[model samples]
Target chain A: MFMAPPATDIAPRDPLLPRIVRLRGKRREIRGVWSLEVVAEEGEPLDFAPGQFSMLTAFGVGEVPVSVSGRTRDGIGLVYTIRAVGAVTAALCGLRTGAPLGLRGPFGAGWPLEEAAAREVTVIAGGLGLAPLRPAIEAVLAAGGRLVLLYGARGPSEILYPADLARWQSARRAQVEVTVDHAGPEWHGHVGVVTRLVPRARFDPDTALALVCGPEIMMRFAVSSLREAGLSDARIFLSMERNMKCAVGFCGHCQFGPHFVCRDGPVLGYDRLAPLLRIEEL
Target chain B: MEIHDLEEVLRGHPFFEGLEPQLARLVRGCARLQRFDPGQRLFREGEPAEHFYVLRRGRVALELSVPGHETLVFQTVDAGEIVGIAALVPPYRSLYDARAVARTVVIAIEARCIRDKCETDPRLGYELMKRLVPVLFQRLRATRLQLLDVYGAPGD
Candidate 1:
């Protein structure tokens, strides 16, 4: 059975002195996106599942909840694909190797891999949404089940993890179909909304479980498209986001209706979120 | 198939399935078998709308071009799907460049012939319009989603 991290363990450390971690390596994934590999300065590697996020504090700069993008197959370090979008994130992105950053819990429920076993898996990611879904994709592929990933970005230049996508496709680990909303010369792939790729994915809709993570509007449309393709709401999951201040449920910032995105989910069943997702500006 | 059997073959397609036999014959009358070599331009964007195609084999890419950039393929219509519905609409002009991505076979139906038949047979016109609506709606929905730029940065 899946177990969530204890709140006590993930709660901010005194809200003053957070656990310090050191960035071991970093690479620019694409323009405005950086992949940071960090390790605990002292102690075992941070334990996290696919879809979980960590509250990374850049000491004086501030903290932000960046999803754990990847874990080494042998599980040595945690990886985060950070988009330099805001103050905290831009600070984190600016850090160099060996920079000390505070780290918090790998909080939030993860993708339901246990339920995904023996079934075809469809992963739909848009823009930075791919960061959180990367681990799940790796897990699903490692488990040897059929996997299909429908990913979209604004343009070819914005697609994260191009090499990994190519590897996944060449290794036959997954059927990864990528699309861009806009493209220049030299891009031969599909150019349209990510949802357009849904119909082209090979899967048994009735037996497939779809894990979607993207902007809310994208997820909304993706869920509708999946439902249209015959996947029940119960079988489709979404990774939701809000103004998350606390990694635990205490803070109300991440609340969506009655649920705390920090605790009940960053990952939630579409059935549970369908009604709330429709409300404007919730 | 022989020209005499074209109606039977067209009827077998899901798009034409359950079409009235008489209407099917009339549609077949407007259609002619056409082949395109790989990478050939079937039609260019902004060209006068003259014909639409029901693909019989291979793929056709519907692409849009920005003046200085490479053309972007927004959608691809494969065998058994129809392309160039813009030919049937008012102010008719091809909306995107259609190119054969592979050696392709299609039933090319002249817009004038379809318009003439529709004007002569209201029932057939209604049926054709009914079928075309879904295709047009699907395209419109996709365009709406693209316009949303759903993959771009989130709102603050």
Candidate 2:
């Protein structure tokens, strides 16, 4: 059975220190989302893995652990897709060209891409969950496997990366299916929860690996559907989130039970998480 | 479609997988092929529900209309999906509108005919219920999840 992927160093070298970065570029992704490209002002680009997150600080506003969206290994810099929900995120969204921000460890485990070699890969994302999975999706695409991407959003306007989705659909090896919970008259595409599309995805139950990210409720349904489709807990992986006070394990604020979300996870295999997720209030 | 063809299709449909050949033949008696042009309405809200459909090709959208807004498409049923299942339950009336989103073909089964078959044969009724219940359960579960409003507001 497949085990959880090794975390990219649970604690960064200078765990307490924040590397200052400057926002090199920014773009509005949707109605309330922004994609910001930040580059380290001094050090080398943070070589992060898919599903890892970094502690981002907006001057004196506040700090939040945001997932590394993409460009992790691209040689350029890192990309963080922020939704203006809370204070720290809203501050990060308002930054302009050359604006300064503090960044720390690209922490936690990532999707099991190395072990997934030669296997069919299925990616399922809901809402902003697609951000962290995007790097892995790009890697899987470059590695040339039968890749299927199933994504769901709240509505038509909330759908992210239309250009990228269309481009991925054009790739010979990838099949992309997008659905939404709601759609207006202008949308002629599929309308339903992402899990509904799981039954129609073509993949080998024994050889395919599935990655899922979204709210806990969405992941619960997605995992159940994937299980019904014949995948074992060992073959599925999901990214988890909690209120992480420190980017390191010392704080213990993000502990699920014994493991800390900041260090032990953020990305975890279903086999390790299934039981915890089943508890009444864990 | 020819009775023989319809029986064969029913025998092999995923929804009816493992159904006895005799039962498939009985279902075929109440089944007929239907083709709907793109934008055609299969059934509308408040209409009497006389039949259910198993999509053979193309897609259908389950929609709802608001007083001042454009029709809302809640779900799309693709090939192999069973639609208009409201026909099988009490107060048999379509709750919402189902329209063909593309040139669609389906095996429309007369609900009353099947219900009558189920009445005479308890085992047949049990078997049919065994299959149909799962479909209802799945659709209801999907609806519940969609209603959670996971993305109703901007969230991290």
Best by DockQ: 2
Off by over 4 Å in 1: A1-17, A171-173, B4-9, B12-14, B17-22, B64-74, B154-156
- The TM-score obtained by model 1 is 0.89
Model 2 segments beyond 4 Å from truth?
A1-13, A72-74, B154-156
- Cα lDDT tens digits, model 2, A1-282, are 999988785554687788788998898999879999988887566678888999999999989999988883356689999899888899999988899999888888889999675898999999999999988888888888779999999998999888888988999988899999988767778999999999989999999999999988999999999999999999999999898878789988899987898898898899999889888878
Over A117-209, each residue of candidate 1 has an lDDT whose tens digit, in order, gives 689899999999999998888888888878999998888889889988988887565798988887653555666788888877889988999
Model 1 residue A43 distance off true place after TM-score fit, in angstroms:
5.6
Q: Considering only N, C-alpha and C atoms within 3 Å, which residue pairs clash in candidate 2?
A: none
Which ten-residue region of model 1 chain A has the weakest summed lDDT? A9-18
Clashing pairs in 1: A185-B70
lDDT of each: 0.85, 0.89
Model 1 vs truth, CA RMSD = 4.9
Q: What TM-score goes with each of the models?
A: 0.89, 0.94
